[model samples]
Target: MQRGLRSFIIIWIGQFASLFGSALTRFAITVWIYQKTGSATALTTGGFFAMAPTFLLLPIGGALADRLDRKKVMIAADLTGGLCTVFMLSLYLNGNLQIWHIYLTNVILSAVEAFQYPAFTAATAMIVPKEHFARVSGMRDLAGNASRIFAPLLAGALLAILDLSQFMIIDLITLSIALLTLTMVAIPKPTQTEESKRAQANLLQDVTYGFKFIWKRPSLVILQSILLTLNFLYTMGNMLIPAMILSRTNNNELILGSVQAVMSAGALAGGLLISIWGGSKRKIKTVLMAQVLTAIVGRVWFGLGYDTLSWLLPSFFVFFFIPISNGSTAAIWLAKTPPDVQGRVFATRRFAAQFCLPLSALLAGPLAERVFEPAMMPGGALASLFGNVLHTGVGAGISLMMLLSGIIGAAVSLLVYVIPLVWRVDEILPDHIAEPSSLIPEKTVDSDVGVKAPEGAASPAD
Candidate 1:
């Protein structure tokens, strides 16, 4: 590998360590919440708590990222997240833990992450060459997918075999190591321009400027909106999956963990495939195909029930497309946007995509429990509508929803595709707008900073 690429790899490894640790604790916390409360709502609290804060703070975070040194922003975010974990771990270890505690800490960490994301994404654009963007995104997602496979399984086993508090301490240690490793790396930051150095503008207005930028870009807006819709469905399915599995297998941990691992493993493989193949030359084709695959698997997986060997077939097919889709979508963003404006643009992108998660979680459980599930059950009310083809059962019901979702998704995809205006990811959006990195310059204190990779170390494209 070239020197820049090698540095990017090293930096990415440090991030992987951080991701693994975070995943470990996250799994522990999620399980602890669910097992303690036995409420689906309780179980998904982390999802809301961890994400809502970031959604709320997107505008500020996006603007800050544009003004600051990306490396400094990321390193600080990591250190802050680690410290938050340390404190939370201690509180739990001392025998004082509550649902509110988890919620509050999640919000804090997530707010920090709000800053971390845009900076890291924008930094990648600056550091990595265009050709390697796809592979780098795949590699980044591969690390996350690898963690998803192992972290839950490990957490499930660890929680079973060891004290939650003790295992949590291990996570704390990992965070410290991640922060320390980051301190050793160097990532170049862009020099400040005159406009970047001028008197500070209103934070809200700067953010509004970003809004205008995206509003003017039809392709970016449509893609973001479509992703929002798709993720809405995806999260809905996810909410119901645990309940369905629990019904079938008497809520077996091994089954749950194994299934999760299998799906993530499939996604990991997809990431690798995309890393190698990059994606379709006509990016719109890749997106539509991914959507079609989603609709197919979403419709089929639920129908398969818990068929030990066969159940994974559709799940694998669907999941294998996710990384390719996600990475390809990211590549479109990276390629289309310039290095300067990406921070704000992508921050909005992330924000819009996740903004509805809380609402989805809030509504999906009840809908499935009282509405969809009952309708799908044998001889139930809605069975009359779907009774002939779908049949009545948890699997059948979920299948109906999936099929419907897929059909809707396909419709949505094609609508945007043929419109021509929204088909191009790059046509409307402006490239990254250059800005000074002095707003949050690198700190003088070396110990406080994470690894600072030399400037211009190129990362592999996905």
Candidate 2:
């Protein structure tokens, strides 16, 4: 293997370890907070603080990724995140840890991740061969799915034997591994284009350039819209799945865990398949069709099913297509956007796609508790009409919500797919060529404006 590819592999391994460690910490902290406070609001509040910063800071992080050494940026992010963990550990050991402290730590770590994410994403595009972009995206998804699959189990096991402080030391160790790997490899910088040079001239302009880049391409805007809509619908249903299952099963924790594990396994399996197959050549079609399947099979079928077997099978299919959809989308962006501007562009894409997640989360609970559940109860309004179909009761309202989200999501996806611009994105947009670059460029450009696609560059659509 070439040196750059080798470096990417090494970095990926380290990042996988780091991601697992972070997941473990998050799981443990969430459990701890719930145990101490016994308040669902507290748990949700912690999550909100953790996620809010990433959305707010992503554009700034993207700008910095373009301007700074990507390796150093990643290392700094890791170090900062590690220190936050360490701080929490110290507070726990001193018996002074509080819910507020955990929430504060989550905020800081999330802010750091805002920077870490874009740097790693842009660096992958920089170091890996363009042909391998889809494969690399699959690998990235695999790491995340693996973390989600195993972290809760591992953290629960460790929490049985160890306190929170001791558990956190493991996270510190993983962060060190990530730092070591980052130091060992050299990441190449993208060669400057005229647009980048001009964008870099003004700090404000640099920060906004990612948004402009996507806006200039009508296809990308529509794609973003589809993602945003799907994300909102998906998150709303996903947030309630556990409640739906637990309520129906009389708070069967084991069953809930089993369902979650199966979902993660499905995602992991999808990632593994994509890694091997590198997805279909028709990347946009893969993205849209996957959404349709995810909504129809995962959400719609899942909602219609009332038993364990019914839920488990559809749950697996729902998560299985998630990685495929996400991997294809990543491959699309990696191919279409120029390397010099990817940090900003990709960050912008992430911000747009995920902006509705928190909103959906916030809304799902109330809609279920106040509106859906009440309406689905026996003799409640609309209960008589849909009762025969969904079986009016505690969790039935959430199930109806899931069913509606799926129908709407599938309809939207199919609608978007038929639009000539969205489905034909791969044909309309040109892939950016990955060129060999020295460790340091002779001159650097900061702006991403008006960089023409490289000549003879192949489109993934072809």
Candidate 3:
């Protein structure tokens, strides 16, 4: 097996273990918040608390990834996050648990995550060969999806039987395993001297430079816009998904868990398929059309008011595309980024992509509960138009939102295509831009090995 492939498996297993524990905890926390406060706003606040700090710190984290050793950065994040859990677990065990404790924990964890996502992603380029990029991406998704499938049911059962404090111990064990995996593997670190030199400017200037890097690169910018809009739609659907189920069904835990499993099953299948089938020749389509469309299809299903497992059969197929889309994009970034700069570039990318997630948490709950649900529930405004195609109700109204979101996303994709500059984004990158060494061959020795030399720089022999 390829070294990258071997390393990928080791890392994936660790992340998979960590994810299972995380999923269970997420479900438990959400339920805990709701049960304690009985307010949607409070729950939204909790979600915001978890993500906002991370988003704000992404630029700083990007700089760190660019300047520091990524392996150390990752280990530090794991350790910091794990320690927070230890404290939370201790508090919960002592019957001193408060919602404030969870909020504070989220903030610290988010700060740590700012480092973890980019480091792990950028490292993949060093370990995996270009040929296996998509497969590696697929396998990564498989680990996460597998966790989603098992975490809920396991968590729900455990939470029902065990105390939340005990659950923390389980989480502690899983995170410890993830950290162990980090210890087991040796990640290759390319020299970052040039990257460090370029980043000598002030923090604001550094962040501005990152934006400029993308602003000048049409492909990356366009892709970011698509992702932004896609995230909004995704968040909207995600916000409503639970509310949709909760409104119609009595069983909260089972509905949430089983539905999650259903979608995760789709992602698992998609990841497996991508692992085998790879993706379309136009890798962008895998991000935009193939896998994204699959995710959108499930949104349409939810909007359509189909709850029974038989009725939700199509969701399985739609769910399959998410990991494929994510994996395909991962391949694109890994393949295109120069190793030295990847730490910064990918960190910014993570920062930008995630910036909107917290916004979604803020907007989704209110929109679903107040605006969309009310407008479309029990003879509301859009009900008649929706009724023309399907039954008129809150569920139907939300379905309209899903269908419209997909259409809007499609239009956005077409508009992006027309921007011609977007298609040539790779061309607009800096002269020094180098592809990851694992993905390409570059003769000159530089800190960021992947960067293409200035137009005239001759090969080493020259």
Candidate 4:
């Protein structure tokens, strides 16, 4: 294997294992909580605590990724996060685990995650050539989707056969392997430039600098605006889908599971296809096309599904387009952003895109339960208008939300394409041409392999 790709593969393998174990633990904990409390509120609160800290701390994390050794950041995160899991295991083994205990552990893990993600994302750019950016993103997506597809089933089987604490133990073991792998690999450091040096003088200035970086670029601003709208609508739809499925299936867990599996399968397939194809040469086009396709297939067809097959078949297309869209968008950022600043920039972008998630989550339930549900009921307002197509039923309100959200999402996607700034974002943004000096050092190269070439000079893969 080429040296750069070799390093990436080693890191990817470790992360893949870590993701699988984390998924197992997550599934087990979610099930354990719901089974114990039988309250969605408790479950939701757990999720909120898990994500809130990470969301609030992302900017600081990005700053650290830019300033600190990426590998050390990852190692420290893993060690601390592993300790949280170990603590959970102890509580569970002693039969003293409380909901608050789980919440506290998740808070600690989230804090670790704020650092871990930026470090890992920045580290990836250090190891992977620019030409392979989309492919690498696809590979990462594949790992995540694989866990999503299989983890629940694995967790279910294990829960039936073994103790829940065992899952935490398994998680700790995977984390150890991940930490060990981090130790073996070497990540390239960014070449210190005058601007980077200036940015590092004050931590507060550095944290805010990420926001300014994106704000200063008109094309990026347009792209981010599009993403913000898209993610908000997307989250709203996601928040309602499960309830819609349950109502449609009469709370049939089997159908729900099958539908989820199909969606995961689609994402897995999409990631695999992107890895091979590397997407469009003009990556912005790839992103736009995927967005439009998903708005149509995912929002429209998904909303219009009247039966099990109708509901799930479109899901395959919905998820299939997501990775393509996300990978292409990531590729654009990877191509445009400086490696030294990628951590902060990427984190800022992520924060902006996801900032609306909690709000959407908070509103989705109320929107469905009170507004859409009541409005879709017999003799209620708009019942006559939508009831014929969507039907006045348990899931009908969710279906209505789906249809509306999809329509808005599609319209916004079309509007994005019409905007000249967003349409030509790739052309307008400057690509960062990396120097070999920022990557692997000559002394570190194997005598057999000789010196490593810089990413910019490396020939595209055959």
Using lDDT, give the best candidate's number: 2
Kindly list the per-residue Cα lDDT of model 3 for residues 1-462, writing each as its tens digit: 654466567777788787777777777877677667655556666777777887788777776766677777777777787799889888887889899888899889878777776666666677667767778777777777777777766776776787777667777788878777765555456655465566567766765566666665667776776677666666566555554554455446666677767767777887788788777655666666653464446555545554656335654654567767676676677666666666667767766665787887787677666776667765787677666664655455556666676666556656655676554443444334333334434333222111100000000000
* lDDT by residue for model 1 (1-462), tens: 644456467666765665666667766666677667765556555566766787788777878888877667877876676677777778887889888888888889778877877777777655556766677777767767776678767776776777667766776676666666665655456544443444237887778656776687776777777778877766666655555555445656666666666767777787788778888876656766776666566435544444445455565554667777777777778776666666787788777766787666666666666777778887888888877776577555555655566666667666666766666555545444433222233452122123322111011111
Angstrom error of the Cα, residue 108, model 1: value is 1.7
lDDT of 1 at 293: 68
TM-score of 3: 0.85
Candidate 3 lDDT score at position 77:
79
Local accuracy of candidate 2 as per-residue lDDT tens digits, 293-327: 88898779888877688787877776787767777
lDDT of 4 by residue, 122-163 (tens): 666667678888987887777667665676556766776867
Stretches of candidate 1 exceeding 4 Å from the true structure: 191-200, 298-310, 377-379, 383-403, 426-462
Error of 1 at 46 (Å): 3.4
Estimate the overall C-alpha local distance difference test score of candidate 3.
0.64
lDDT, residue 147, model 3: 76
Kindly report which residue stretches of model 4 are placed more than 4 angstroms away from their true locations once superposed.
Answer: 33-44, 94-100, 156-159, 243-254, 377-383, 436-462
Candidate 1 has an lDDT of 0.64
TM-score sort, best first = 4, 2, 1, 3
TM-score of each: 0.85, 0.87, 0.85, 0.87
